[model samples]
Target: MYHSILDTSVEFIKGVGPTKADVLKKDLGLFTFRDMLAHYPFRYIDRTKFYKINQINPDSQYIQIIGRVISKKVIGDKRVKRIIAVFKDETGIMELVWFQSLKWVDTNIQVGVAYVAFGKPNLFNGTFSISHPEMELYQNRHLGRGNLTLQPVYNSTEKLKKFNLDSKGIQKLIAGLLDQVIPQVTEDLPQYILDKYQLPDKRTALLNIHFPKNQQDLNAAERRLKFEELFYIQLQLLHNKQLRQLKFKGASFELVGEKVNRFYKEFLPFELTNAQKRVVKEIRIDTQRGVQMNRLVQGDVGSGKTAVALMSMLLANDNGYQACMMAPTEILARQHYASIISLVSDDLVKVAILTGNTKKKERNILHEQLENGEIDILIGTHALIEDKVQFKNLGLVVIDEQHRFGVEQRAKLWRKNVIPPHILVMTATPIPRTLAMTLYGDLDVSVIDELPAGRKPIETRHLYEGQRLRMFGFMKQEIAKGRQVYIVYPLIKESEKLDLLHLEAGIEQLSYQFPRPDYQMSIVHGQMPNADKQFEMQQFIEGKSHIMVATTVIEVGVNVPNASVMVIENAERFGLSQLHQLRGRVGRGAEQSFCILMSGNKLSKEGRIRLETMVKTNNGFEISEIDLQLRGPGDITGTQQSGVLELKLADLASDQIILSEARNTVIALFEDDPQLDKPENSMLKAYLQKLQRGISFDKIS
Candidate 1:
């Protein structure tokens, strides 16, 4: 078998032997020439400007200087060991330091030798020193504005630093390997694509990406690389989508009959929002086509996603098929079961609820009913995915807060029916359009952007610790109005590392303020036993308690219509997605609701932005876009689980336009040549086939 030149091991590269290559592999996951070339810089520093020691200040930017080393000394013990070299220019003297590669630096630098030094200057005591300076011998090198102006900075670990493989070291290795690899890089994109998008060739993009002379070239490089990365990802995703259609013979609920109509007219909790109606239509279109329905339903809190899901299940029931909805937690399962039960007539469709908390006798009866086809709809947590829990004629499977469940867990439900059941995964956490495109690109997406009628937006506010008294008074006033409240903390118990408000302390303080019988309280957290937690939650649900003190367990929970106030303690500690989800717990009822984000005065810039973003808008999609920007692609909700966004250069937050164009182009290409059998797209077809087999495209794509 032939291999690409990029497959050449990094150990074979010049200046990087076996020992250094092993270190590189361990420290930065760089094992081959391809990985090295793909390691793009996070940022760049201009090395054009030159400065003298006398021209430096504490606040000066990264500067380059030419100086001769007069003296060098090793200082401090083993842990704090560092090399301090004094360099003198025509004007004055400045300190050059190396704390990482001490021995290497000590051996390399010669006393009274002229060298070019570049690094950010920092003031230690009274002297300005450049730590871990990039140094090269000054022989006949140009003194003013050298040709290599923009220098790339790659990420490196502390261990890499010890091996002299810092950002500077990695860049040096890449600089040497680029020439050998550039010619090997091939153009995988079709000529039409290249011409239409005006994308540069593969070689030009890779060349300029690592070592661009100017910003314009860098932008062009990024544009092309980002397009290729996203293009291949979408191509693979679309291929899978096409294969899924070809593979699975799905349950076709052709009859939109009695149950679906009756439920829509008489039992829907509220009038169907246009978004929900449109989604139902989409589901109908998908199921009628005889292909498996793998659709993602993204909606904000109280946006009637559950209603849409229930309606879809009714379509299943009407077609003589059993439907099941799975939730992440028992509370959520029971909540879904109750809502679903209320939506459909007991005589029309039998509904059963089973959970981990269900008694053995009850579970046995439930399992028997499920297998016997007596139960038309079964709702539960992970317990529903058990081997014994068989569905008679299960057709529609709705997974709520789907991220909480694993891939295998979802697959088990698919295996329940011989023909893989129609799958509808739902989440109230609205994913950004770009993120949704990448994460659920294979699955058709239906978003419920509008909330139901008569529902008011939850007014959110940020409060500091000093305003506790005022917040307490406001809580009391709300309680006086016969409305319930929720106080959520970051920690269940005192955490030594984090200065967060523990639920224990929070409840204790609240008890003193609200006082005994006048204000009854219920506490729920993850640490509590199943029965105890459920009991507390039920107490709050039944309006037996005025306040519910808990951790984030309340985030995905049963809705309490009377609960109008949600106070999130240490709000800065929560991500934007989490903050939004927690705030969603309230504002489910007709009455006005409030989400008071309580935090310390000292908040990081990102933390402050999160709270402000929450206060600024109730739009989950907007919050998701900002969240994607703040957290990047990996950390945003469920993208990590999908593993599709393990992109080298494309950022889901910033590269929406590129992703859309690439996806559309791939889609158009597929429409023309579904099998990519066209002679015009031969290279592109071959590249995708290799990608499907887990081959790295290297810089080709």
Candidate 2:
């Protein structure tokens, strides 16, 4: 359980000098022997299997061919120049073409020399050819036949290839590093744990990973390494949760007093859904236990999350503590402030809104009221974390769309009070179960799985551009029923590369169709001034306009219950979550609502699936699961910035079993030896410490 000699600089390796070392560090983030070791290959080549030239097809993927070069020639003029070599095996002959570095290939390659070539094949005019295949002189091919089972292929960049550092070059460097450093590596796992898991020792696993003796050894190496990686991640999360709970004594709210009772009895806007009541009860229990509550409230749109949050805030208010809510956008903050004000108008509790748009005089009054405990609840955007804003006794913090804030920004709010406040982050974007397990593992989760009664599911349909005239008839029918409409465009201006509909052109055509005297249209986009955007949104909310033609800026906070139809232009351009959110904008009122997804006839496979999923169901969780499958774990929105889901081997979507097992093991270990002070747990502690040095867990935890 000591530091690795692999921590030595990459430049010290025999094959990597200062120049190549710098390029490796900048391009691949490889600077030390350990870095190189952890840079696992994307795939492996079966060197033992060689394909004949005659057996190769155009669709063949990276086949290894044993052949001899018969002739070499340069073809075409200077502009279309290429080096073509006729290579023949015993079965047949094929062509190897290189469009780049023709001079080097034509001069260095010799005819009638036996060689081994490897690359993907392409077909043109009934002949198979390979472009830029890796070639090596074949000598003593049978000397180490059994050893040529698998060849590791590292990923490389075009820049690295210019310096002669392709996959083969990187493989050579790694081989040299392994020979020099593998002897010094020691086992990090305890003997008992290793025996129980049937995992190999660290030295053996490292060697086998880079150069496996057989398929069995490779499987063992992969399992051992994946376990180590996932184990440390779970350990850090679980350990941090334990430490936080043990150290921080949360403010206690023992009684549900005046504010909660009065709101329920007199000023209740609507009967609380059973789901909302359950979620509030969960929050109430957390607040009264004198333990910090870090909870995630996940619910789909129109699912009463705001009602749950308001009730929780009232719980804090009844205990003589102030509550604050932060949203990702100013408009969302204002919307929350307006709704809460309407709900609590008769109640004695005070509420206020703060954002970048607050004037100097209004800001001063609001600031003074917050310090004097006059404002029981304050909702704002990023302005809530500013230094000038101080609360009398901030107890609970609710963040909507919490992923929009960075780790540091959230940390600033956490440090606002002497004792960190209980945090409740709400998300309308329904997270798939496996993703939630990995991303929000440390927090307690409560899901409001049901929408309030009397809310109708939005009817969604997919339409092609050729059916626009019929779609316009549907829009006019909805408008004639005294309901407003929302037409959302993916782009504000047209782009030459993309043929999708644009907002300006859409509005102009719509204006012509429904004429200005009879129909009023409001336009908004991100590029507009905040004041102008606000004005346009206000028009839609107040029913001053019959239709709002704009971009996705209205996707989140503009709640117009009267709007019964939502038409998304080029719906194929949006992600699954975004399409769901936009659909959520309607279906807020008692009237039947419809969402029309307009797209071109030609659609990619994923695009077709997305539109069809929207048409299939309104369930956010189901859509998220399909999204995880189509987009992958890394490409999901908000995952890239968190750094929590940067999994190298374990797929979040598919490896739930492994993730759960790893989490259970960490929890069991901590339950037995809370501080890892036992002799048997020392190796685990040492390994965890080493892993922590490479990753910054503090901010994330």
Candidate 1 C-alpha lDDT tens digits along 1-701: 12367778899988889899998888778888888889999988776778989999988988889999999999999999888999999999889988776767888899999998988899888888899887878884443223667778899987777767878778778878886767667776888998999998888988888888888999999999899889878988898898899999898888999998888787776778899889999999999988999999999988888888888988999998999999999888888987777777787789989888899999889888888899988999999888988888889999998878888999999999988999999998888999888888999999899989998999999999999999999999999999999999999889999988899998889989999889999999898998999899989999999999989888886699899999999999999998999999999899999999999999999998999999999999999999999998677665477667788888888888999999999899889999989888887777767776887555442
| True-structure RMSD, every candidate | 2.7, 3.0
User: Any runs in candidate 1 off by more than 4 Å, and if so which?
Assistant: 52-61, 67-99, 105-115, 122-131, 140-146, 691-701
What's the TM for model 2?
0.93
Off by over 4 Å in 2: 57-59, 71-87, 90-93, 99-111, 140-146, 687-701
Best by lDDT: 1
TM-score of each: 0.94, 0.93
Residue-wise lDDT of candidate 2 within 43-132, one digit each (tens)? 778888889888887678889898999999999999999999999988988899998877667766789899888889998898888899
Model 1 misses residue 335 by how many Å? 1.4
Scanning candidate 2 in windows of ten residues, the lowest lDDT window is 692-701
Q: Rate the local accuracy (lDDT) of all candidates.
A: 0.87, 0.86
Best by TM-score: 1
